[model samples]
Target chain A: MLGYTLRRILQMIPVLLGATFIIYALTFLMPGDPIAALTGERPLPEATVAQIRQAYHLDDPFFVQYGNYILGVFRGDFGIDFFGRPVLDLILERLPVTFALAVTAWGLKLVIGLVIGVYGGLRAGKAADHFALVFTVLFMGIPGFVIALGGQTYFGVHLGWVDPAGIRAGWPMAFILPALVMALEAAAGLARLTRTSLVDVLRAEYLRTAKAKGLSPQRIIWGHALRNAMIPVVTYLGLSLAGMLGGAVIIEAIFNLPGIGGLMVASINNKEGTVVVGIATLLVLVYLVFNLLVDLTYGLIDPRVRI
Target chain B: MTQLLEVRDLRVQFSTAQGTATAINGVNLSLEHGQSLGILGESGSGKSVTARTIMGLLDMPPAKINGGEILLEGEDLLTATAKRRRQLTGPVMSMVFQDALSALNPVHPVGRQIGELYRVHRGYSRKAAKAAAIEMMDRVRIPAAASRVNDYPHQFSGGMRQRIVIAMALALDPQLLIADEPTTALDVTVQAQILELLKEQQAENNMGLILITHDISVVREVTDQVAVMYAGRIVEQGPTAHVLGDPRHPYTLGLSQSVANEDLKGRRLPAIEGSPPDLLALPRGCSFANRCPLADEQCSSSAPPLESVGAGRTSACFHSGKVASNVAYSN
Candidate 1:
């Protein structure tokens, strides 16, 4: 198991390199000079523009600029943005808001998905199972942004149940709508996956053995079937963490929240290459770490996976 | 000895897309305290279904107990409430299934799997359950029971896993243990060991046993009486020695002929011709009439009821006396 984990960690190096290369290459291929964009529509002396380009390594070849950026990253320097602010500090300041939204959404999805899934799986082909199946399918079919908008109008404007937009001192209530909207689609998929996987596991021979052992229905489901069924669910949950981070961009934009995803999008529109690439690198790191944790969890949930 | 389990005219049917298949039809079985009954049959002969129905493990929508009575210690299991059945399962009777690896929960440790019986039914504390698990493991002859108890199902070898399954089944000392093809998934040497362990345990506990297997030698070695089942019905049943030595029903005669005999080592072993009858559309007369060499107009036109032969034997064949004499002369 340790060997497998170490090997997986080593495998992440190329994925990280590829991610950094893509982000760097994308900025390089962008039309017009970043320094010119930085200078905006105001006219400047040719020497001043050239000096600005040279200082930012914008005057160098693509490979040279990319190499220099990679070196800066290794040295913990994400470089300065258009406003002369350190991109790392900018990302750090915005990290908490994004983490709060994504983590809460992930938590909501996990809990709700698992509950619906287990209920549906245990009572398969019954009314509860049918309801859960149809509910998840409907949630999955609708887009997340639509839900966010609809929720804001219904829960915030019409019902006055929540603020619907913006973080307040009592942020938990403020986060509810956005977080729930963020969770809906993923939770629906998870609920379906959980239901199917649990149904399959419940049909396994060991559950019959558990029943023959005179275990209560609760013990058989929770103690025996649920543990084995959660293996695939854990993998999905880990992958969903990466997905939630990426998904937060549109959700944050829709809700007008100041999370990293929103920051990345704003930077992209402004062609602030440093901030965009810096945030992209952080996301890539998060993706790699979560995948590694998922692999480790496989061993924890199923002993056979350790080999 | 008092009867421990009495199954009278048990009929089980499954509603499939094809049709309503009668898996077990008009099966009558009874076991006394400390007696072992080996139910021998080929694949798809309803051996496992019978065991599952007896344990109340079959799901009702697909599988229905069309008609029957399963009386455990004079209490009808069919009418028993779900809670009452659950209460009776672990302490009153339990079953060991085929395929030990799949039979034991893959996620739990062996000790925990065995200990769960006591924890759920008896409400044993974790410490006490663990101790009892070790003791059961020791009884099943799993080496280093104290240390190995913590190991998961995958950690143990197949035979050891099967032993763990048996240990779990008999942990609460249930009055009856129904092992459904328990050794079918084991190596020959390991099969012998498991059978021996089961026999010893049954003897020690004075519990009734139902050993279901396709292997004739296994049945002969472990059971006092044998019932030959073909297409959901018992073709013949009697003391093991008497039945195997001189089979009455043509189906049982054919089955005994299929077994490898040292006296006929030089020649090809005989096999029962034709496959088992289709369960979805069984013959109105006798299920095995198509395959029985002695089958005639009477055999094909009407099903023969189980009739008494001499010496506490029963055979469901019109020509039981003739077939037994023919088999005797041939031997």
Candidate 2:
């Protein structure tokens, strides 16, 4: 198991490099000069531009610039943005907010998804099952931005539940509504997947054996069926966690949470390649780690699966 | 004293997309203590359904008992409360299913599965149940039961897994054990081993065993009495040797001929022509009329009732006298 984990971690290096390279290349290909954009109204003089370009190695080819950036990254340097602020510091500042948001959304998704999914699966072809199906379809059908806008209007403008936007009101209060909005689509998908998986597991022949052994219906479902059903649900939840941690740019924009997502968008618009590439690198690491965790979790849930 | 089990006019039906399909049609059976009865049939002949219905394992709504009384030592299980039935299961009666790989829960250790009976029915402690599980495993003849107790179902071979299932079913030493095609998924040699184990367990516990299977040789090897089923009804029933030796019903005669034998080498074995009748829209007359060579107007006009043809034997056929004479000509 230790060897497997080590190999998985080792495999992440190439993936991380590839992801960072793509983000850097895309940012580099964007039109307009960062230094020129920095001095928007009054353009910088030729000599000052040259000095800044020489210092930042902006005139070098893409490969040379990428090589320099990678070398700096190995030494824990993420370079600087157009505003002369260290990109690593900028990412670190927003890390906690994004972490809190992602965790909240992930928790909400799991609880809501599992509860509704299991309920629906157990009562399949009945009213509860129909309700779950409709609920999932409705949520899944609507786009994320539309849901965010509608939530803002209903909860913020009409009901006065809490502040419509921004994190000024504090940790949980500000996070709940946006996190819920962020959680909706993925939760719907998770609930549907859970329902399908659970329904299939419930009908498995082993469950009949459990019943024949004279186990009560409750024990049959909870003890035997749920563990097997959880295999696929766990996989789905892990992937969604990785996705949530990658950040929801639209939700962050609408709710105005100063998260990594918002930072990423603002940096891209300003052509701050260092900040964008840094955030992308962090997301790549998160994805790889969660994937490894999911694979490891499979071995634990099902003894048949060896690491 | 009451028999170990008695199923009188037991009827089972399934509501399918087409219509209500009568899977088990007025089947009657009785087993004495320590006796083994084999229910012989082809696929979809309701042998498995009968065993499952007896175990109360069939899912209702899709499957419903139209009319029946399953008496376990004089108590009508059909009238028993759901909780009462549950209490009876594992302690009073239990079942072993086909496909042992699917029958045993994959995630749990084989020992835990076997031990679950003691834990649930006997209220044994976890440690006690584990010890009992190892003991049951040893009884079923699983090698190194103590060491292999923690291994999951997937870790075991097919035959060994079936042994684990048997150990679990017999854990509480229930009066009745319904094994539905238990050896169907095993190798020929492995099948013999499982049968031997079952026979040994039955004798040791003096348990009434109902072996449901399509294999004639298996039934002959394991059971004392036999009931040949066709279209969900018992067409012929008597002592295993008597029924197999002189099959009174045309269907039973056909089934006996279908088995491969040394004398029939290089000769075309006579198989029962046509498939079993569809449960939905069954003909008013005999279900086997279409497939029987002796099917006449009388056989087609009305279904034959099961009647005594000889000592301790019953055959559901209008022309039982001719069945024996016709068997020689078929050869």
Candidate 3:
């Protein structure tokens, strides 16, 4: 098990490098001189521009500049952004808020999806199954921002449930609307996955034995069927960390929450390459860690999966 | 002897997009305590369906019980409430399946799988259930039951896994145990061992055992009574020795001929001609009429009822007497 984990960690290095390299390369394609954008309207002297370019190694070849950035990332030295503030520090400050939204959304998604999915699976080809099918299709087709905007319009501005936009720190209520919108799409996908997996599991031969043993339908489903069904659901949920992060970008924008996703968009517009690259690197690392955790959990859930 | 189970005119049909197909036709069967009955049939002859319907395990939308009276000790199970049937399942009756590997849950320990009955029905604590499960593993002759109880289904060999299935079935001391081709998925040597285990366990528990198999030799070895099924109906049923020794129906006679004999190896082996009739479009007269060499105009015109042929035997053939005399003369 330890050897497997070590190998996975080793495999993650090249992927991280590739991801950071892509983010670094994308910055160059942003169609503007980042230094001029940083100075913005108050045009700086040519000497000052030269000085700034030299200090940041902007005068070097593209490959050389990327190499320096990679080294700086390894040293935890993400360079200054357009505002001359450390990109790493800025990202770190927003990390907690994004984490809160993501976790809440994910937790809700799993709980709701599993319950509804199991119901649909148990009653496959019946009323509950049809209802779940229609519900999933509707939710999955609609965008999270539409749901967010609708929620804010109805529950926020009209009903005075909370603010129409923006979030307050340490306030659980402020997190509700955005988290719910983010969770809707994820929950729909998970429910569909869960329903399909469980429907298959219910048809397995072991389930026949379970039924023949005189086990209550309830026990048979929860005990034998769900345990086996959970493998695929776990796989989807683990991989969904990346998906939730993407959703959070749209969700954070809609609600005006100060999360890493919101920060990312602002950085993208300003052509702050350091901030974009730094956040992208951190996301890749989070993705790798989540995948590792999922693999380990597979061993715990299913004895057939050897460490 | 007390009747443990009885099925009267039980019919099961599967409704499909094409049409409804009869899986089991007007079948009648009964079992007494401490007796072993073998249901012998080829594939699609409703052997497994009979067992599943008896267990109340068939899903009802695709599968519908058109008509039936499944009685457990004179209690009609078909009309019984779901709760009542469920209550009787583990304690009164249980079933073992054909494929041992698929029958056992791959994720859970074999012992826990066995112990599930005790935990759910008897309300035993987890530790207590584990101990009882180990005892059952020992009873089924699994080596190192104490340690091996924690092992998963894939960890055990085929024969050993079948033994585990038997252990689970016998755990609740059910009055009736249905083994649907229990040894079908095993090797010849392993098949014999699993059969032996089942026979021993049945004898010990004094349970009514219904062993379903296509192998005539398996039925000969393990059962006291035997029923030969042809196209969802029992064509011949009586004592196993009597039925095999003197088959009255052409279908049963045909089945007996297919059993390979070492002495007849150099010659052409006798085989029944034609395939089983299609279930969706069976002839009004008899399903097996086309396949029977002895089938005459009367056989094709109308189906023959299962009639008593004296000596506690029944045969569903109009020329049963003629077939019997000819078979007796040959023997």
State which candidate has the highest TM-score.
2
Put down candidate 3 lDDT per residue, A178-269, tens digits, no spaces: 88877887898899889999989989999999988888888888899998999889888998976677678778888888999899998888
By the TM-score metric, which is better: model 1 or model 2?
2
Q: Can you write out model 2's per-residue Cα lDDT over A115-234, one digit (the tens) per residue?
A: 889999999999999999999889899988899999999999899898999999988999889889878877888888888999999899999999888899999999999999998888
Chain B TM-score, model 3, reads 0.97
* Second chain TM-score for model 2: 0.98
Check candidate 1 and list the clashing pairs: none
Worst 10 residues of 1 chain A by lDDT: A166-175
The lDDT per prediction is 0.89, 0.91, 0.88
Per-residue lDDT tens digits for candidate 2, residues B46-67, read: 9989998999988998999999
- Candidate 1 lDDT over A187-228, as tens digits, reads 888988899999999899999999999888888888989989
Candidate 3 per-residue C-alpha lDDT over B1-331 given as tens digits, one digit per residue, 9 for 90 to 100:
4479999999999998999889999999999999999999999999999999999889887899999799998899999998888889888999998998998998999989999999988999999999999999999899999999899998889899999999999999999999999988899999988989889989988999999999999999999999999888998999999999888898888888877799668767788878999888778887788977677899899999999986889999988988855532121
Give candidate 3 regions above 4 Å deviation. Answer: A82-84, B324-331
- TM-score of chain A, all candidates: 0.95, 0.97, 0.96
Q: Give the Cα-based TM-score of candidate 3 against the true structure.
A: 0.96
DockQ, in order, for the candidates?
Answer: 0.84, 0.90, 0.72
User: In candidate 2, how many Å is residue B324 off?
Assistant: 1.2
| 1 versus 3: better TM-score goes to | 1
Candidates by lDDT, descending order: 2, 1, 3
Cα lDDT of model 1 by residue, B1-331, tens digit: 4589999999999999999999999999999889999999999898889999999999887999989899999999999999999999989999988999999888889999999888988999999999999999998989999999888899999999999999999999999999999999999999999999999999999999999999988999999988889889988998988898888888777777877778878877787778998899999888888877677889888999988987878999988988965642122
